[model samples]
Structure formats: C-alpha cells, structure tokens
Target: MKIYIVGSVGSGKTTLARKVSAKLQVPHFETDNFVWTRHLKGDIRNEIEVRDQLLQDAIILDHWVIEGVHKDWTDPGLQVADQIIFLDFPSQKRVQRIVKRYIYQLLRIEKANYKPTFSMFLRMFKWNKYFEEQMKPEFIMKCNVYDHKLYRFQTDKEVKDWFHQIQRG
Candidate 1:
C-alpha cells in the first residue's frame, strides 16, 4: 500500500501517516527529509534534482506512507498512491497545533525533523495563512482529479474513526 498524506502545516499529516504506517507495518517517509538537507550552518533545501530523486525513491517503495504539505513536488507520489489522505482541519485548529508543536520543539521535548527556529515558526504561520487563502483551492481542485483515491478528514474525531475503520479492515 502506497499512501500519501497531504495538508497544511500542523494539519496532522505526519501524525496520521506515522499511525497508519505503524498500523500497516509499512515504511514511512517525510517530505522534509527530501526537501531539506542538514548543514553546519542550518537546514537548506536540496537542489531540485536531488529532491526529485529522493521523492522518486520513496514513491517506488513496495509499501510506504509519505506525508507532506508540498503539492506540486509530490505529484508523482500522488499519482502512484493507493490512498491519498487530505487532512482538512480548520485554520484555527491547525494554528493551535502548530503553536503547540513549535513550543515543544523549542523546548527540546519533541524532536524536530528539521531545524526549529523562530524564523521557521513564523514561516510556518505564513504558510498556514497562504494555504488557507490560496493553496487550499488548488489542493481541492487537484484532489478532484483523484477523487476515487482521496479520503479527507476535517476533525480529529473523524481521523480517529477512519483509523479505526482501517484497523477493522
């Protein structure tokens, strides 16, 4: 099973992907690993070539769950996914989650996959706003193209219910 989870920052894409991966015993990949490279200075995005190659490798996995907010760069994975989960949580809820996660990461209580900085936190808020105002429409439009494979959830309760259904299946 190849699963792709897409949503705005803090929409629980990574959390759901991790849960699903554990439940299914499938490998999981985060787009952050592909998109950003660690350096002594800070985290930097990989070149387009490197990013694309990494994404290709993950998509070719026999069974995998990949999660990210990236859309255009993840088109290939979407095309190959058996299921595409769209976490459509409300903007207020997402922002709350983001703030909570950022604080945890800042305190070193939670391990961040990428460098955690105040600037990054601010950028996340900006991204969230952009997603709400612009990218969401695009995401909806693109998802329509894969309606058969799309499973969308707007609340944590709905996500839990869906996860239970998957477990039962």
Candidate 2:
C-alpha cells in the first residue's frame, strides 16, 4: 500500500508521514530529498525523474508512504496511493512549527535535505496564503475528483491516533 501525505508548509505532514511509515514498517519517501540538491540550496534537482523513479520502485514493492507539498508536480507518485492524509492545523500552530523549523535550520539543527533560509518565513506565509486561497479547495476538489480516500487531521494528537489505528489494522 502506498500512502501520500499532503499539506501546507509547517502543517506536520512530514512528521505524520514518518509516524505512519514507522508504525507500518514501510519506507517513507520524502519529495524534498529528491527535489533539492542540498539541504537548503533549492537548486533544481530532477523533480520529475526522481519522483517518478521513487513511485515506480514503490509501486513494485508492497508498502510505502510518500509525503510532500508538490502534489500537482508529483501526480504520478500519487496515482497508486491507497490513502491521502492532509494536515489542517491552525495558522498559529503552523506559524509556530515554521518558526521552530526555521530556528532549527538556522542553527543547522534540522538536518533534512532542505536548508532554512531567511526568506523561509516569508515563504511559509506565502504558502499559507496559497493554501488558504488556492490549494485547500483545489486539494479537496482533486481528492474527490480522483476518488481516493482522504483523511484530514486538525491536530497532532489526531494524527497520532490515526497512526495507532493504522498500526492496529
């Protein structure tokens, strides 16, 4: 089973994905790792090719969870996804997470493939705007349009509960 988790920046999509993947003992493919050249360089990596390869490899396997923001750009990755999870935390929570994330990045504490930049906060705000103004409705529409099972969570606790449910199943 392949699961896809999507949400605005700082929405805990990656955190939830990691939990789900760990619970299921499934590999988690983070698009950020494939899309960025360095931790924060934002250089153009083969977004399409790498994403496609990851999807192809996972499809041939039995289980995995893929998560990221570039849902439209990674349409192929979502094709075989059995579940789609979206984090809909409040703006304040999102802001807090983003700020914490940036602080960690600035301190070189968050060692993910992406780096934190000064503009990351602005980007976070813009991302929130885009999601609120555009991506949310579009995502709901596409979720229904595609007829895939979609799960929405408002808090980290809910996400944790869902992970337990997945584990129990």
Q: lDDT: which candidate is best?
A: 1
lDDT of 2 by residue, 6-68 (tens): 888889878778887787889987777666555233566666677567557765677888888
TM-score, cand. 2:
0.84
Q: Count the backbone clashes (under 3 Å) in each candidate.
A: 0, 4
Model 1: residues >4 Å from true position, as ranges? none
| Model 2 weakest lDDT span, ten residues long | 34-43
Clash pairs detected, candidate 1: none
Instruction: Give per-residue CA lDDT, model 1, range 22-92, as digits (tens).
Output: 99999999998898887767789899999999999889889999999887988999999998989999999
Question: Model 2, stretches more than 4 Å misplaced?
Answer: 39-42, 47-51, 146-148
